[model samples]
Target: MLKKIGIKDPEKQMLKLMESGAVPYRGVKQKDVRNALEERFEPQVLKSMTDEASLAKRYPGVPHEEAAYREMRRLTDELNSSDKGNLVEDWYERMYAQRRAGSSNRPESRQHQKVSAAEWNKNRPASEQIKKDRFIDRVDSVNIGGKEKPALHEIKSTKGKLQERDKEQFEDMMKVAKAERNGVEARGADGRMQKVDQVVYTLTDPRGVAKNEDWIVDQLTKYRNNLSFEVFDAQGKRMMIDARSLKRSKDGELVLPDGIRNRLGLK
Candidate 1:
């Protein structure tokens, strides 16, 4: 689920973004953060982790031991937070990340006792965990009012399925953003540089991505015409400036967002 959200360090990155003024949707307070997060995640985005740490009561798609493990961990965190709803919410993410980390810390090369296929099937359900590598982040720059204005954009992927057309349309928006950035960069030294706006496209899905070829091609073509792109540093941060307020970076790149630069600390 976290894998499908397409963030290498979602908790950390999101924390940084929040500090940078990317407020939570619907104005979540510290108290509301837990319910907000449960509504936002847990079901789809945190499925993999939640399933891996279950309770003794047994949950569908999750077994007794793991569910029990999760329940125990939950109690531990509650104790640590003194049962404060907000603090518990914060600790919940950390605990979840820690559990995920612990589960993945093992060396995969180690081999255990072999078992018959039939026996393994009957007992191995509790051990199998989903392993996936998928990314869905997008960016764009566009022109507005035909005045060569720039609008930089970012797109987030959801865990659900999407129609190819919608995906392509999103890509088109990014292309426009990139093109708008280019036009502004090419603008003469009139000191009256075209304005640029930053836009965003966030898509959330639960069943994972569904590829759409025609939609992909259409988006690719449209973005090709725009020829717009946002390079990243190591941290998945944007590494370009908006058309209106671009300041050339020492590394021959434009000013980028802090969240992006942090993601790519190399730059």
Candidate 2:
């Protein structure tokens, strides 16, 4: 009867259906067979089936273990092809880099393991820790004093949209910053000149960045502030000018901000 219904491995399929607890009676009516086939053939349903990890527990060793391993590898491959996967990969690289740099002073026993920022603070005295309402410190590597230190092993669900983007823009911005560190020539349009600690380039997105220009600039500004880097000017450089400093003169032409005027000691 099972073969008449087109079941290739009627005996095996019957055993599986019975094991699944979906079929009770050994008599096995046509509707029951049809229901099993319908459930098995649905792709969406199959994709959402119990994960291979759970399968490993039910069917331990040999073929089940091999199948579970292959499924895990396949799922990992699929994840690595997506935006989130790229972020996770980059974060792991950063964590490894920090660990290799010896930036963390954690004990020998804990050195090898990855500890989340939240977990790191869990048992510490309140005076020794900063209370974080959310897990922003869960970044793979966080800036500790002036050194970059790895803080967490596992990627928490708390990371927001910022992790989804590439850090290429930040890298390119750092090149301009390096020049500031070397020495920037601040030449004004009116033939004025001065040099400062670091030049902030405005209206510019770093290499490979073509979208969200304004938001990226704002984020860069915020990042610079957090890094304790002072904003500076290039002689007559508008890109380095603060938005607040950009104002309309009596003639309606764009003029430098009041801060710039004060910096230049102008009225």
Name the weakest run of 10 consecutive residues (lDDT summed) in model 2. 201-210
| lDDT of predicted model 1 | 0.34
**TM-score of structure candidate 1:** 0.23
The prediction achieving the highest lDDT against the true structure is 2
lDDT of candidate 2 over 172-195, digit per residue (tens): 223323332222233322234432
State the lDDT of candidate 1 residue by residue for 1-267, as single tens digits.
244434486677556655665546446677565455445444443333344443222445554434433443333322322233233233333433244333422211111112223332333232231122112121222333333322333332222345555455444334333432222121212334443333333211111212222232234343433333333222112333233323346785545344533443423
| Cα lDDT listed for each candidate | 0.34, 0.35
Off by over 4 Å in 1: 1-151, 163-210, 227-267
lDDT of 2: 0.35
